[model samples]
Target: MDICHEAPVKCLAYSPDGKWLATGSEDCTIILWDSEGQLVQEWVAHAGEVWSIAFSPDSRHLASVGFRREHAVWNVMPGQGAPKAMILEGHTGLVVSCAWSPDGTLIAAGSGDKTVLLWDARTFQLLHRLNLFTLEQHAHAVTHITFSSDGIRILSASSDGTVKIWDAFSGALILSLEGHTCGVNKACFSPCGKYIASASSDQTVWLWSIDDGSCVETLFEHRADVRHVAFSPDGMTLSSGACDGTVAIRHIRDIILVQDTDM
Candidate 1:
């Protein structure tokens, strides 16, 4: 077994190349380890628990967020050398999630304030703030966010039981997918951009068509609230981590169609 962390590991991710393992904790630290699970380095980035983390597709940069109100980045070193990593700032509320655009040109983060902030990958400057409407749309905290394969749209899930698609460049709302009876905790587009999967507190995962936002299937596999979901790089497998602490893998072939003519 691998000794992954010294505290409760909140979120974890593998580098695009599958060479590095990045783990975040509530102890205000982010640890980087090799594929073998041996710690290479750790950095303190926030005042409270580090809630989420994401690796740039290149595997050279890391973006981390925490509850105590801060966000940071690190230059991941492969072996024994030290790196002079840089920390970025600018969220007043606790940062809930972070992700890198496909080409790694932009970093997008969601927070408790019900907004998503976009940042320049190189300069680390705030590029835009995506504010979700309340009276007309989402009225609760934005729990998570993801970028589509082409990086032209942003997929945001919220505590309002809905996921909204936004134009990445203009921040204009495009589509909203709603079907889960409870709040959606996380949502991500399939690697091929053909499908979208969302994890919810309703104890189910919903798969929707990317083009029409139509419900494709409802995966009621997990016995408890689903906490997270990820599409394997090949887009053929789906993995979900639940509040029950079980990571369940669902193959794309198993997502049943709601209708015989469903695309």
Candidate 2:
């Protein structure tokens, strides 16, 4: 589709209601598009390449992190003079990714600084800091972190090749799973919070039993680096993306192919 102004897309996010999409680009801007893929709003979304973007669960706001650690939350509707919101900054290194907690009260962000920072969505105040190294396990940058469906636990992936689970509110790491031969790019909790799926540059995806820190399964069909993964909202299927230029959909339990589409 003919998307927007001259720029290569870097990342994309869909609103919670699935009514709109936001595309971040190398153009240092983000284009807002309606569900039909028509442009609704476009503006300077970042000072540098916008790396990641997410819409608030309420669908009233948008959030982005890019251009070397700069993070911002914006009002979603068309606006003018002053920015719809304020800029957020605290990480010592590049801000890698951020997501809203299931409860919608906290925003959790992972950083190149090797930490996950939690902030109050309304006050923009730091609420908690989850230091990866403090656990005496991870020795590299934290790439991504997501909350469990219960909103009481956080699962994070790091360049140190491990995925760690922590108490969401107290910032206490509960378990560290070390299996990937290479760095872990991402770790995500299933919609039901019963499992955690991890993607690694080691060419495999590991499904872990979140309740006991046991690996339930491993999928290695990609034959290349696996970068990201997510469970379908219903928990019936899983989708994964890789450097192999493929997106595969598989049955969540048996890893059977429901659909495999190359993108």
Candidate 3:
């Protein structure tokens, strides 16, 4: 199943309902596909490369951001020529990553401006501007942001080699997980909200305790910069992708066994 686009595909997301797939490309366009891989709709989404895309929890809308300083949310309901999208303006730097809150009320985005902005998903209004530098104060760009499964916390990765946890409602910095030797590229929360997994340019994936902000284990299988990390919906497995063009999936049980033996 090879779905081709005119330019490099930078990011993609699946609708929460599992009915649609949206792909963002360097061609400045977004194409929606059905489960059968049929193109449902295509539209120019941004002026530059589309860096990231995320679907609302209800699967009614898709949010995207990119090299363009702004982000957009599209009503991607089926049966449309060009979906109606609203542009969100405010970020001064390229928007790099985005995620919808578990409850679907908010969308959080990280940018090269070194800040994270929370938006009202319904009204497309800015709710909070979290300046990482002004808060916990980081020296580099915020690369990624995601909400905890319980929707109570926000996890962010930065080019400064640290992952920061924030109180989702207060927009207050909670804890800084500092262990990566280089920039942290991505971070994700376990499905049960008990742990955080982070991928780093240091070529490793780190599992950290959400309870105490302690590094649980550093998995060093990736031969190059690790770009992404994700936990299975069941929270029993972890997967990572790297610049070395490889993806590794590890069972959480195995990780726990290794940790116990090392202790």
Candidate 4:
């Protein structure tokens, strides 16, 4: 099935239930596609390019951020006609990324101002601003934000060439994972929560051990900036996408097995 957007798609996401795929575009609109590739719904979601979109854990809602400097949460469940959005405004700069917690209780937004804003999903309240502009914090725009599987930790990728993990509840900086020579575009924890995979503009994907905070493996298969990285639901496979127009899938079960054996 083929679908078209008026402008380039800036971000895309799949519902947790496997029912819908959402695409946000530079045209300032969002389109929801059913599993069959039929358009489920379409609406303008932001005043400018929509940088990111993420579905709630239950697939009942979607949180989006963009060049508009604010994040909007939309009720995307079936039968909700052009649902009203709860706008979260606190960022002093354009919002670049947003993610929903696995439990659906929180939303984290990262911005050009180099801070991650944590919001309560239920009340749509701004709970914490995760950066204080200290020397150790992100020196550049935050490129991505994600919550760990248990929702106890949050990760933020920055153009400063680092990924930082934070305590989700108290907004405390836990660990800083650094090594990328260029900006990190995205990062996410493995399903088992033992590792983190980060993609970078250096054209590499790095797998890091969370407990020891060390680079366990580095893959240099991409010829251009690596834009995204994710682990399979079962955590046996790793996938990465790059600006070179390719998706790379690697079997990571062996890597985990090797680590377990060494331990």
Best-matching candidate per TM-score:
1
User: lDDT score, residue 117, model 2?
Assistant: 87
TM-score of each: 0.72, 0.65, 0.67, 0.69
Looking at model 1, residue 33 earns an lDDT score of 69
**What do the candidate models score in CA lDDT, each in turn?**
0.75, 0.73, 0.78, 0.80
Model 1 per-residue lDDT tens digits across residues 1-263? 23434555566666777666666665677777675557778777678877788889899988887786677877787565665556666677867888888789988887777777888999989899888544235788677777777879878898999999988777788999988889998898876677888989998989888778899878877877877777656666666656554555566765533332455
| lDDT comparison, 1 vs 2, better candidate | 1
- lDDT of candidate 2 vs native? 0.73
Tens digits of lDDT, candidate 2, 128-161: 9887644435798676766676668777789899
Ten-residue segment with the worst summed lDDT in candidate 4? 1-10
Q: Which model, 1 or 4, shows the larger TM-score?
A: 1
Model 2 misplacement above 4 A: 1-15, 18-44, 74-86, 89-92, 101-133, 139-141, 168-173, 212-214, 220-224, 244-263
- Count clashes in each candidate, considering only residues at least 3 apart in sequence or on different chains: 1, 0, 0, 0
Off by over 4 Å in 4: 1-14, 18-44, 75-92, 112-142, 145-154, 164-178, 244-251
lDDT of 3 by residue, 191-220 (tens): 667788998889898999877888998898
> Candidate 1: deviation at residue 79, Å?
3.7
Candidate 3 Cα deviation (angstroms), residue 238: 3.9
TM value for model 1: 0.72
Residue 41, model 4: lDDT of 89
